[model samples]
Target: MTELVGIVLVSHSPELAAGLRSLLGQIGSAAVPVAVAGGTDDSRIGTSYARIAAAVKDADRGAGVLVLPDLGSSVLTARAVLEDHPREGVVIADAPFVEGAVAAAVTAAAGADLTAVLTAATEARHVSKL
Candidate 1:
C-alpha cells in the first residue's frame, strides 16, 4: 500500500490551520491525511504531539509529513512534537506557513519525492519580496 503523505499545520490561530485543511480539501486532498495543531478561539494548543504522531503513523506508508508553521513558536512546537514521537518512513519538512502550506500540500498530494517537496518548501520560504 502506498503511504499517505501527512500535513501538519501549526499556527498561532487554529483558524489558519483549518483554513489550510479546507484549502487542501478544495484542492481534492480530502482523502489525504492532514492535521492541524494550534490554538483556537477558545482552545489553546488544540492538538497535541500524540495526535500528530498518530496521524503520521496512520499516514506513513512511506510518503512523509510536511510541517508548516505560522511563527517561531510553531517551529519550536513542531520540532518538539516530532521529537517526542518519531516515525519511520516519515519526514518533516521545515517550511514557512503560507506559501509552504499550499506548496507542500500540493506536492504531497501528487506524491512528489521528498527532495522536490523540501526544495519547493525552501524556495517558497525565501521568495518573499520583503
Candidate 2:
C-alpha cells in the first residue's frame, strides 16, 4: 500500500494555513491530504483544537499526521489536540511555518515516510533566515 501523508496546518492565522495549502498545490502533490486549523476568525481555542483533532482522525489512510503551527495559541491548540490523539504515526513538529510546509509537501510528494518528512520539515526550519 502506498501510504498517503496527511498534513495538519495549525497556525495563529488562517492566512498561514491557506498559504501552506497553496504551496502544497504548487508543489503539485495532490494525493497528500491536508487539514487546516486556525486563522483570522478561529479565536476559540477549544474549537481549533477540536478541528485539528478531527482532521487528524479523519485522514483516510491514517498513515501519519504532520502538524505545523504559527504562533502561541496555534502551538497550544495543536499540542492539546495531539495529546488527545497520540497515534504512533502522528508527529507534531515545532518548525518554521511556511518553510516547514513546503518541505513537508515536497517530502510527502516523494512518498517518504511520515517520520522522515517531519524530520526534514524540522531541519528546513533552521536552514536560513526566514
Candidate 3:
C-alpha cells in the first residue's frame, strides 16, 4: 500500500491547532493524518520539544511528515526535534501555518509523495492575499 504523507501543526495555543484541525476536517481531508502539537504538556502557552517530537512520530505513517509551526520559537522547537531525531522524509515547512497545513493535508489526501506534499506546503508562501 502507498503510504500517505502526514501533517503536523504546531502552535503555542492548543486552541489554534485544534481550530486548524477542524478547518482542515471541514475542507474534506480528514482522512489525512494530522497531528497537532500545541502548547506544553501542562497546557502552557509555549512550544514543547517533547510534544513536537511525539507528534512527528505519531503523524508519520511511512510516507513522511510535514511540520507547520506558527511562530518563531515554535519553529526553533520543531527544528530542534528534527535535529535530534533526524528522521528521513520529515521536513519543517517554511510557510504560513494555516495555509500550509491545509495545502499539505489536501495534497497528502490525494496520495502525493513526501516531496510533493512538502512542496504544496511551502508553496503556500506564494499565495496572494489581497
Candidate 4:
C-alpha cells in the first residue's frame, strides 16, 4: 500500500495548533501522520522555522507532506522552511487554516496522493457556511 500523505499544521498559537491536532485525532487521523509547528522556541506567540521544519520531517513518512499555515508569519515561516529544505514531496497548501487542515487530514487519511490531498485542502475554501 502507498504511504498516506502527512500533514503539518502551522499556527501562531501552540494551543491552537495542539487543539486542532486533537480534533483531527478524533477524526480520520488513525492512518495519517499529523504534526504541529506552533509558537516559538520560547513558547511564545509566533512562528519558527526550526519547529516547522522539524514537524514536516516528523510527519513525512516517504509519501509526501502537506503544510497548512495559519495567518501572517506562520505562512512566511513555512515558506522559509520550504526554501531551506526543498524536498520533492514537501508542499505548502494555500488554503484556509482550520478548514484546510481538517480537509487535508481527512483526504490524506483516505490514502490519497499529495495532489489529491492538496486539492482537497485548497477546495475547502469554497465550503459554504450558510
Candidate 5:
C-alpha cells in the first residue's frame, strides 16, 4: 500500500492550530495524519521547538511530513526542529498556513508522495484571494 504523507501545523496559539485541524477535517481530509504544535510547553503564546519536534515525529507515517507554520517565530521553530532532526522525508513548506495545510492535507489523503504534497502546499502561495 502507498504511504500517505502527514502534516504538522505550528502556531503561537494552540487554539489556532487546533482550529485549523478542525477546519481541515471539515474540508474532508480528516483521514490525513495531521499533528498540531502550537504554543509552548507551558501553553503560552510562543512556539516551542520541542513541541514542534514532537508534532513532526507524531505526524510522520513513513511517507514524510509537511510542516506549516503560522508566523515568523513559528517558522523559525519548525526549521530548528528540522535542522536538529535532519530527516530525509521531512520538509518545512513556505506556504500560507491555512491554505497550505488544506492543500497538503487533501493531497496527502489522496496518497500522494512527499514531493507532490509539498508541491501542492507551496502552490497555495499563488492562490488568488480576490
Candidate 6:
C-alpha cells in the first residue's frame, strides 16, 4: 500500500496535544501517522521550535506531512520552523485543531494525497458545531 500523508499536532500544552492525538485515533484512523509537537523540552506550558521541527521530520513518511497547530505560540513556532528549515511536501493547515486533525487523518487513511488531505483539513473549518 502507498504511504499515507503524515500529521503533526502542535500545542502549547503537552497534554492537549497528546489527548487530541488519542482522539484522532478513536474518531479518525489508527493507521494514519499522527505525531505530536507539544510543550517545551523542559516539559513546560509553552511551544518549542526544536520539538516542532523534530515532529515535522519524524512524521513525514514520504507521502507528505500536514501540521495542525492549536494557537498562539504553537502557530508561530510551526511557521518559524518552516521558514528556517523549509521542506517540500510539509504544510501547516490553518484549520481547527481537533476537527482538522480528524479530517486529515481520516482522509489520509483513505489513501488521499497531500493536496486532498490538506483540502479536507481546510474545509473542516466550515463544520458547524450547531
> Over the stretch 1-130, how does candidate 6's per-residue lDDT look in tens digits?
8999999999999999999989988875888888999899998999999999999988898999999999998998899999999999999999998888888999999999999999999999999989
Off by over 4 Å in 5: none
Q: On residues 2-58, what C-alpha lDDT tens digit does candidate 2 reach at each position?
A: 877788888666666767787788778767887777654445432376667776776
lDDT of 4 by residue, 1-130 (tens): 7789999999999999999999988985767999999999889999989999999999999999999999999999999999989999999999998899889999998888999999999999999989
TM-score of model number 3: 0.95
Worst 10 residues of 2 by lDDT: 38-47
Winner on lDDT between 3 and 5 is: 5
- Judged by lDDT against the true structure, how good is candidate 3? 0.91
For model 5, how does the per-residue alpha-carbon lDDT over 8-113 read when each residue is reduced to its tens digit?
A: 9999999999999999999989888899999999999999999999999899889999999998899988888888789989999999999999899999989899
The local distance difference test score of each candidate is 0.66, 0.76, 0.91, 0.93, 0.92, 0.93
lDDT of 3 by residue, 1-130 (tens): 6778889999999899999999998999988888999998898899999889999999999889999999989999999999988999999999888888888989998999989988998998899889
User: In candidate 5, where is summed lDDT lowest over 10 consecutive residues?
Assistant: 76-85
Q: Model 3 segments beyond 4 Å from truth?
A: none
Let me know the TM-score candidate 6 reaches against the reference structure.
0.96
Off by over 4 Å in 1: 40-42, 45-51, 58-61, 126-130
> Candidate 1 lDDT, tens digit per residue, 57-81?
5445456666666776656666786
Clashes (N, CA, C under 3 Å) per candidate: 1, 2, 0, 0, 0, 0
> What lDDT is reached at residue 126 by model 3?
93
Best to worst by TM-score, what's the order? 4, 6, 5, 3, 2, 1
Tell me, by TM-score, which candidate is best.
4
TM-scores, each model vs. reference? 0.75, 0.84, 0.95, 0.97, 0.96, 0.96
On TM-score, the stronger of 2 and 4 is 4
